[model samples]
Every structure is written in structure tokens, then in C-alpha cells.
Target: MSFIESLTLMLALMYIASLSYWSGKKWGAVVTLLLSIGAVAISLYWPLALALLIALPLCLIANKFAPEEFKTEIKINTLREGCQQLLALSLFLVAIQYCINAIQLKQGSTPWLMRPDVVDAFLPIAGGIELKAIVTLNLWDQTHPAAALMLAAVLLTGLLCKRAFCGWACPLGLAGEYLYALRKRFIKAELAPPAWLDWPLRMLKYLLLLALFYIVIGMPSESIPYYLQGNYHKIADLKMALFFVTPGLITLACFALILALAAWRRQGFCRYLCPYGAILGLLSFASPLKIRRNTQHCLIEAKGMKCDKCTRACPANIIVHTKTTVRSDECQACMRCVAACPKSAALGLSLKSGHRVSHKGLLVLLLLALFALPLTAYLAGFWHSQTPDNIRMELIQVIDRVGH
Candidate 1:
């Protein structure tokens, strides 16, 4: 099948699965399962099918042995941490494989496996900006299908769950969480910038978004800034891979700085500097699903007192107890506030229609659909680069010469 054809089929299946699940009917699970099987069959991707098969039984077993409701919070947190670690490890392995491929290429040997452009796929801002260039500058043939698909996945997630991807799926956020945990364990305390300082810094990402839009849409293609240019973007991607493959002083220093900032203030980069996250945050304001506070049941209100546990628990520092519905752009739907609330039913995730959402199950399904579609296309030989091998080789040579 052609790449676009495969992608279309995958998207159709995803839409069906998502719709079924969103219906919140008893049979939604069955329909989603069938659609998943159909997706595997359509793509002829046995590996994905096999993984799902294995996972289904394990999930069943886990559900059967699941802890009581009150005890489940700890289990859920553990599961989230485990998933984050697994994702981080998977990225590390991919980096190692890419390095091996590069080494083989340098030694004049044909690498058996080519590295997929997964990093670029995660870059939704870059994809959106490139799409603008395509539409405004008539760069029709330069469509990056993988990146486009990834951006669509992210936006779809935002529509459904309100920045759930940032909370549950972002590797960088997971890393920041880990760093914060470590800092708390070692230092016993962490500091946040004063609200006056933080408020201004938080505006930086929006300004950056405006600047990037100008670069992608206002500037002529030939006059685009150096780092934002195509070849240079590829070089940056290469450098990212090299950070894992062959870490240098710069990479280590940058990593340390990020960790330090994350330790100082949870999700510091995401809160202040991530243009992609800023875009998602804006879209998430329109999401129907959000954390709702039962003010009447809240312990603080009940006692005619003030308790800031939920606020303290929030990584985004949102005043969760004050709002009946958390519609803040900064809310990532992490549910930390919900878990931290001492009063039962004081906090929960719900749709605007008042239907409560099952956080873990729905989030897991969304993430599964997001990754499975692209992976199925990849397995169908329809998701890799359309660029000629000779051109790619030439670009690699140039990157190596520039010592990026």
C-alpha cells in the first residue's frame, strides 16, 4: 500500500475507535478492541498485534487482582512512573540503534536497519510551522507526513483530554518529575520563582510562538533564520541523537541545567519555555473534560477553613480548590490534586455534561491509539522518509563536516 493510503486507513480506524470509546457505552470497549484488531489486519503489522495480545492478558490479570479504591492511588502513581521509565528506556534504545546505523554508514557498510524519524515526529511545532510554509509559500511537495500525523495526534489528544499528553506521555515532563522527586528526596525542599517573576516568564513561550509564526510564514524561504532552516533542523535532530550516542560537554551541561531547573521548580521548562506546550495549553482550554472541584464537599470549606493541599500538589501550581471547574490553560490533567484531596469526591475529572471520566483507562487508550497508528504505517513500509538515499547521504556528510 502507498504511504498516504496506509495513513488514511489507520486514521479511519483511529477515528472509529476514538468515537466508540468517547460514546461511554458499555460496548465501547468491545468496539475499540475490534477496531484495534482491524487496524493490525489492515496494516499487516503482526508485531503490534502480538504486543496487544500479550498486553490484553496481563491487563486482565492486573484488573482481577487490582487493589481497593482507596489503595489504588499509590498503584496508579507507580504505574505512571513505570510507564515513564519504560518510555525513557525505549527512547534510549532507539538512540543507541541510530548511533549503530550511523557508525555502520561511516564504515562503508550498509546498515540492516534505518532509524525512523521519531524525534521529528514528536516535534509538533516544527511540523505546524512547516505546514504553514507549505500553504503560504507553495511548498506543496515538501509535506512531512509523519510530522503532520503526529501533530494531529497531539491536537486530537488535547481536544479529548486537556493536555493529558503533557502529563501522561511527554518524556521531558516525565524526566522533570523524576528530577523533582530526586530533589525533594535529597534537599527536602524545592523553591519556586515568585509569582510576579513567574507570570512574566510564562509569557515568553507565547512570544516565542509569535516569533516562530513570523519566521515560518513571514520570512521568505531563502531568508529563513539559520537554525530554523531545513538542513539546520536536521543537524539539530542529529545532535539530539548524538546526546545519547556520544554525549559531549555541551550536551551534558545542557542536561544538567535542565535537571537543575526542573528540580528547583517542577516542570519549569514546560511552564515557561516550551512553545509546543503553549500551543497545546491554548487548545486545551476548549476541552470539555477537566478536573472538577466539589466545593460543598471540600474539607476546607466544610470546616470554614483554608487548606491548600490540592494547590500544593499541583505541578502547574493551579489553585485547584478555588475553582469549581479547572479551565486553566496551565492545567495538564495530571490528577495529582485529585489524589491529594483528603475528602472523598472533593475532586475528580469530569466532562462538561457531568459524566465522570475514568482517568487511567481512557488515557491509556488514547496513548495506545496515538502510537499504534503511526507504528502500523511504519510496518506497512509507508511511514519512512520519501527523500532519496543519495540526498540523505549527502546531508549526513555535510552534518559530519560541520561537526554538529
Candidate 2:
């Protein structure tokens, strides 16, 4: 099969599976299994199969050994967080290795995984800008298929589960959340910025987004033709990768600043500085699913005090107890609020139709599906850049020379 054909089939299967699962159909598992088999058949890849094999038993074990409702939320959230951390750390190490391998590769050989570029590929802003440049400059030969695939995956996640990517997939977010947790446990206090300060700070990302769009799209037509021919953007991507792989003093300082801020306030970067997250937050409003509050069941009013457990647990710091439906663009759908609610069913993820989504297993299944589809396409030799090896080698050489 052609690469586009294989990619289309994989995505179609994923959509079917997601729809089935979200609609509470019993055939969700059947469709998922079919997807697994189809992926292996198309890619001739064993990793997807092996991953599914391992995950199946783990999911079963989690369901079988499930704790009481009160404990279930924490345990599941912890497990999810651990998985995010492990994946992030593993990917970081792999990126470092990719850089080393790039330096050592023979002139004609391409790296198998292209790990250094994966994060860039997944960044919608970067991809969207590149795509626009390609179209505007009529540079069909300079296509970035990997970036396109990543954008598709991200958009799919947004449509299906809102900002689940921020809570469950982003490595930077994992680190931020861990820092926030440490602050909560060790410092035993919340340190939120005042609303007057916080509200304006949140506008920074939107401004950054606008600035980037202007730079990419508002360039003079005469200069754009020349700009596209130059390797400016590719070099910028390499610089970003190099910053993470071998942190200079400035990069280290910036990393420290982010950690310190996260320790002071939960998801500080996500709230204020992530341009990519800003886009997702806006797109999340189109989502049909949301965290709904069952105020009638709430115990806080009975006790003549605010039971702000749900509010306190929200990583986005949204006031969950007051709203019948959480429509905040900042909501990550992390389910911490649902778990933190002492009263059973006080907070639940529900569709607009009022159908409550209560199963932890389904969330796990959705996460697995999100990860599995792109991997299958990648293994099938569909989701990668078509950049010439000579050009890639030259770019690496430039990065190595300038990075030092």
C-alpha cells in the first residue's frame, strides 16, 4: 500500500475506535483489537502488537485490583502521571541519543527514528507555520510529512478529549505537574498570583502566537521566496533540539525558572507561556465532553462550608464546585477533580447529552489508542520527513558548529 493510503486507513480505524468508546458501545474493545491487528498487518511491525499485549494484562489487573471509589481516582491519576513521566524521560534520553547518532552517521544514512525532531513535529504552531510557508512559497518539494501527522494526532486528541494532551502527553507539563506536587507536599501551601496579575499574564501566549503568525504569514511577498530557500527554520529547529540535549547556561536558567514558577503556582507555563497550549485551549471549547458538577449531591453546602476539594485538586485551578459544567479553556480533563470530590458522583465527565463517562478503563483505552495509531504509521514508513539525507547531514553539521 502507498504511504498515504496506509496513513488514511490507520487514522480511520482510530476514529472508529474513539467514537465507539466515547459512545459507550460494547464494540469498542472489538474495534480496538481490530485496529491492533490491522496496524501490525499494515506495518509488519511487532512493537505495536507487543505493546498491546503488555497493556492488555495491565489494564485487566488495574480493573481487577481496583480500589474503592475514594482511592480509585488518586491511584489512577498517579498511574497516569507515572506513565507520562516515564515516557517523557525515555523520549528525552532518546533525543540525546539521536543527536549523538546524527553526529556519527555516514553521509548517506538517515536516522531510523528521527527522535530529535519528534517534539518539533508535534508542535502545532511550528507545523502550521511550516505548512503555510510551504503553501505560500509553492514549495511542494519541501514537504514535512512528520509535522503534518503530529498535527493530525494533536487535533484528534483535542476533538476527542479536550486538552488531555497537556495533562497526559506533554513532557514539559509532566515536569511542571511534578514540581507543583512537590511544592504542595513539602511547602504545604498554595501560592497563586493575584487575579489582576494572573489575568494579564495569561495573555502573553496569545501575543506570542500573534507575533509568530505575523512573522510567518505577514512577511513581504518579495522576501518570502528568498526566505523559504534559506535553511532558517530548519536551523532554528536544530538549535531548539541542541538546547535540550546539551543545555547551555541560559537554557539551564530558563529551565530552573520554569520549575520554580511551577513550584509557586500550578501549571504556570501552561497558563501563561505555552503558545501551542493556547491554541488547544481555544479549540477545546468545541469539545462536547466536560467536567459536570452534580450540585444536588454536593456535601459542602450541608456542612455550611465550601467543599473545595474538587477546586483544590484541579491542576488548572478552576473552581469546579460552582459550575454545572466546566467550560474553562484551561481545563485539561485530567480527572483530578473527579477523584478529589469526596462525595461520589459530585463531579463526573459527561457529554452534553448528560451521559456520564465513569469508567477509568475507558480513559486508559483512549490513551492507548492515541499513542498506538501514530506509532503504527511511523513504523509503517508513512509518518516521516522526505528531506534528503545530504541536506539533513549538512543541517546537522551546521547545528554542531553553531551549537558550540
Candidate 3:
């Protein structure tokens, strides 16, 4: 691994540990912010790692340009959230594009993978040198080399942006959000994450991580990619195919169950069953962005709009009314409170000021993310190297009907 990458892993690990110790220490968040900036800088910025020189101010602008009331330091009138929602109407667009391409004159299924088609459009990055290739991950085929870096990228982004990936980038999150909208329309249950169930349930996602590892480690190392390479792919070796095709409807069912939980208790999936949410929730402890309060200016003093609205509107169920300080790392930086605050003084993400975060914990997360950098990369490459027998060179001759 490159020294900088090693340094990054170290920093990410330290960030994780510090979160465990202090949970939401401001210093830890600061450290994470710096490290995250540095990682991106070194990896993508080249010789200077000067991305921070640019990024920090942008984040400040994100905070300052947040909304007028938040910037005013005086009144509260037009605080209608500016954080853009990352909802995907792309599914419909892609579906439309597919219909246009259909050779079929008439078919019930449209044979084009109509409306919410499973196809993914290529996303060029690094000046189009790299791309987000289309992908699928069902029960049989699992690990996606094209996706691991994407996952890691999201994981790393959590440090500064809070849950921006979930709030802004993840298509699955959009799906979940849409389901949630449908849920509110059909049912009204204020499900609470009961203390007994809440903490235990969050462990499920990691268990899922463990399950993924177990499935991967058990498969023939050579055929891993074929299993993960997505649908109708030739990788359908008997054992791997059986395992790959395994994720089942239970996956959707799981979301349905989580949605049901959220309907009853707010953010039930995030608070409980989502592994990514679990990691984000844990790492979020070090997020530089957060919801803050000024107890002195708080509504509890006058009992009007000061703190009531921010706390009430917080979908995460964080008690913003009570938290005068940016103490909880679990905040998503969703800016919901920033928008909802009738008294803008009640919430904002601070860069310099906050309770002290643990510098020691920062050290730990740095070490870990650094270590995982190459390890995860190697694993990614390793998984990809294991080609499936179904993908045999000889088979191409049989299918394409041209001489090999």
C-alpha cells in the first residue's frame, strides 16, 4: 500500500475508535475532517494534497451559504432547507430509454426491462478515465469489484459529509425514502425504537457483513467475480450459482420489515437493521457536521420556535431541543434542523468550536482505515481474479456462434 494510503487507513481506524470512546467528541470530528480531506487530497490531488485548501472553505460555504436565517445571527423567517434531496427520477428515465431501444413490437414485459429497469448507466469519473460499470448483486453472484471502491468511497465520505451518501447519493436510499413516503400515505404508526430492541437490532447489518464475508470466503476464490459480476452473466458454476442466486425476495422483505419498523419508530432501519447505517452511525460520531443548540437562545427559555421546531423536525429523533451542544455524532448533517429552526441559532455545523474531541481516538481510526486500504484492495483484486468456470473461454465460442 502507498504510504499515504496507509496513513489514511490509520486515520480512519483512529476515527472509528475515538468514536467508540467519546462517541461525539468535537476534536475527533475535527481530526476526521482533516484526515478525510488529506486522504482525498493525497489520492486525487497529487503532489500537494491541497484539496483541503479548497474543500474546507467549500464546507464553510456549505455552512455559511446554508440559508439566510442561519447566516443572519439575528432573525428567523425563511429557513426552508437548501440541502438538495438526491431523489432519483433516473429510474424512470432509464426505463424510458430502454423502451425506446426495444425491438419488440409488443410484449407484456416490454422485453426492454421497462420502468425501473435493472440496468445502470455508466458514470465516468477521474476525467472519464474510470467508470461506474453497470452491476448486479443477487444471492448467487455476490462480490462486485466495480462496487467495492464505491462502497469505500462512501465510507470515507461519511467523515466530512455526514450521511450525505445516504441522504444524497445512494439509489437504494432513494428507494427506501420512496417506500417511506408510500408508508406515510398508507399508515401512521409512530413506532419507537424500544430500548430493548433498538441497540440489538443495529447489530444485524454487521452480522450481514459477516455473512457476506462468510459467503465469499467459502466460495472458490477463483470464481468470486463471476458470482458478483451481476445478472445472466456466464459465471453460473453449480456451487457458486446456487449460493449466488440465494439473496432472494427476503432482501426486499427485509426492507419492508425495516420500513414497517420506521413507520412505527422513526429511522428504524438506520437505527437498527442497516449495516451501512450502523457503520455510518458509528463513524458519524466523528462527523464534522452536526446539529447544535444555543441553550441561552433556546425556546425552552421562551417556549416558542427557538428549539421546538428543530427537535421536532429531526427525523433521526435526536433530542435537539435538549442538546445545546453538537454532542451526538449520529446526526446526518441532513440540515433538516437547519431548515426547520424557527430560531436559526438553535442549530448548525461548527468547524472550530465545540466540546473537545479525543485526539487519541483520531489516531486509532487513521491506523485502521489505512490498514484496510490495501487489504480491502487486495481482497477486491483477489475476488475478481477468481474467474468462474461458466465464464470459460471455450463457452464464448458456443454462445456467440463465431469461431473462437
Candidate 4:
């Protein structure tokens, strides 16, 4: 996007976010849906006839779920009930964008992947938190800055609202969640990742985090972007082609294999493998906005109803089910538990206006250090930018190994 277009989007989002924050109207959600629609419309790749599907979000506006969070609660109106569905609908429009690209690729209408013009940041890739941060720090200049800021805003919202963006803002995550709804019927039960496996999986992201750092800090910084730029082609394009033709098809095969694992373990990939999620989990810690627990009205003193639904619905397997108060980094703020609790167990989301960050500066510094460490590594020659020709191949192999 150009400077003016970028400014317009930022102002629009800020106006909408603040409007929702202050007025407590449903307009915030509406604006969010509109922006997603606007994003789709901006592409203009979709058929004009498809605009008729405005009914998708229209239906969502009618089905909003009540909040019902506490004893005297601020329940969402009808619009909240179908927020997820509307979000999914908006994202489905984005999938249309992706499908257009795929179609263009097949028809020889365009050379997309390696084509700097069509490839780079033009594709529909969102919900990757690390990618967001990297772009924020200007690590990926090729990325659309407006989109990056929009993503950052969404991430900040998630920090404040507990993964609200995962369910509401992220186009890609919406696709996954929608697919999971269908996949769930065929599966048995959801299990938290086991300690041994889960522990190892957590390291994968942390390691990938460090690897990104090493490439940035330890490698020659000038060389790093070339590596990233080239690898963008390899992963997004070369890999797509090789998926059908290569002997090293295990990587392509892993996509389905991971989904199968998710069937057994709900959000297994999200829980343990997503580097973007790991960063958010870290940054969100110091987020002044936190979920407030209504300790006085909790379940231990009450009857039949307790905190069963929130934790049960938690993809992160947050242990809200057993606790009077729970504030783990793993919480996604999906609001399943908030909406699911029978007694309205006093669990409420809090909009923190201010807090004591000075006392927590050490931890805040740690998060910053964690972020800068990767960039330093790129400039310093610790990453895999040693050879430009093979950097793309190497990064994929690295990402595949670590992402799995």
C-alpha cells in the first residue's frame, strides 16, 4: 500500500477500536467486519457477484451471543453470538483471495511465488505473531507496513482480551478453527499435550526464535534479507511445486500428519509449535490488560456449577477448570469458559488502564531482549545466510524441522 492508503487504514482502525472502547457499542465489531470486507474488496480479485454474500456477516449481526460473564454482567448483544461465524465468513473471503492466486498459478496467468511483484507480501498470510513482530522491527521491509500495524493492533487486542483476535481477527486462524469444528465430530476427545512431548515442543519455537536471532545477529545483516527474500519464494512456491513431485515429500506429508495429530490433540500445533504464538504469550504477559477473576463469586462455594467450561474449551488447556483464579500465559482469551460457566462464576475480562510496569521492568526487559536477540543474530552472522543461492532451501529445512 502507498503512504496515503496506509495512513487511511491506521486511522480507520484506531477510530474504530477507540470507538468501541469508549462507547461500548457494537460498532467496533461491525467495523472489524467491515475492515475485513474492505480488505477483500481492496483486492478486487473476487467476483462482483460475490458481494451478494454480505448476508454472511448480516446473519452474524443477528446472532450475537450474550456475554453473561459475571453476576451482573455486560453480555454481548446478538452480534456477539455470531462473532466467530462472521469472522470465519470474512476469512472465507480471504480464502477466495488465496484460491484466486492458486488459480492464477495453475492457468499460467501469472508467475506468483518467485515473482517479487505478486509474491512477497501479497498473499493472504496472517496470524503469525512472530511474523508480525519481525515486520514491526522492520525485519521484513517487503511486508506491507499497514498490514503489519493492523496485525500488531490485533495482537495487542488479544493481549488485552485473551486471544480475542485468534477467534475474531485472524483470517487464517479462523479457517483453521472452522475446519476444526468439522474435524471435531470425527475425533474422539481433546487431550492436552503430554508433559514430555509438550515440553519438547515448546522448545521448538524457542529454538526457532533463537535461530531467527542467530541468522539476524550472527550472520551478516545485509545478507539476511536476501536469505529471507529468497526463502519466501522457496517455501511459498518451490515447496508448493515439490509437494507433488519431490522425494523429500515428508515435509508436504507432514501437513496432513499434523492435522491428524490435532484431531487427537486439540490445537496441538498452536499449543506447542507456533512461534508467533510463543511471542504473544510472552508479550501478553506484561500487557496491562488482564482477565480479572471474581474470586468472591467463584465456584468452590457454589453448587453444581463450577469453572468447567472455560478450561474445557481452552485450546491452550488453561487450567481455569480447577482454579478460583488462573492467569497463565497459555490462556487464549477465547471466552469459551467465560460464556460456558453455568453459575456465571465471576470470571471477567478486565481492561487495564494502568499498572506497575516499573516493578516489572526486568521481565519487560527480558521480553525486549528476547525480541532483539534474533535481530542481533542476523546482523552478526549467526544465521544461515552464509550462501544466498542455498539460503532458501536451508531456511525451509530449518523451519520444517523446527515447526514440526
lDDT of 2 by residue, 1-404 (tens): 22223333343344345435444664875767576676677667454455545555554464456564423444547655765775576566655655654655434466554434354454454466555655666543233445645666676677777787787778878888778888899898778888899889888878887886777577665664454455654454556656677898998998888778878888998888887677778778987778988766877654566678899888787988888899998998888888888877677888988787653543554465465555665665655555555676677666656431
C-alpha RMSD (angstroms) for model 4:
10.6
Off by over 4 Å in 3: 1-87, 91-145, 210-259, 262-264, 301-306, 326-329, 354-404
- What is the C-alpha lDDT profile of model 3 across 50-156, one tens digit per residue? 43444445545644455543333312112111111212443344435434423231222223322111221111121011111222222221222323443454567
lDDT tens readout by residue for model 4, 1-404? 22222222333343333334334556654764465456446545233114324434333343344232411133432223344454445334443444554445545455242222111222224213225337444474333222233334445554544444443444445445555666777764555566887778767766765665454355444554554445453354334433444545676677766565545565555555555556666666765555554555666454445446666756666777566445666665555566666555366555444231211221122222222332233233332222232444355445444221
Better of 1 and 4 by lDDT: 1
Best by TM-score: 1
Q: Assess candidate 1 and give its lDDT.
A: 0.65
lDDT of each: 0.65, 0.65, 0.45, 0.45
Q: Which candidate model has the greater TM-score, 1 or 4?
A: 1
What is the alpha-carbon lDDT for the whole of candidate 3? 0.45
TM-score, structure 2 vs. true: 0.76
User: Worst lDDT window (10 residues) for model 3?
Assistant: 120-129
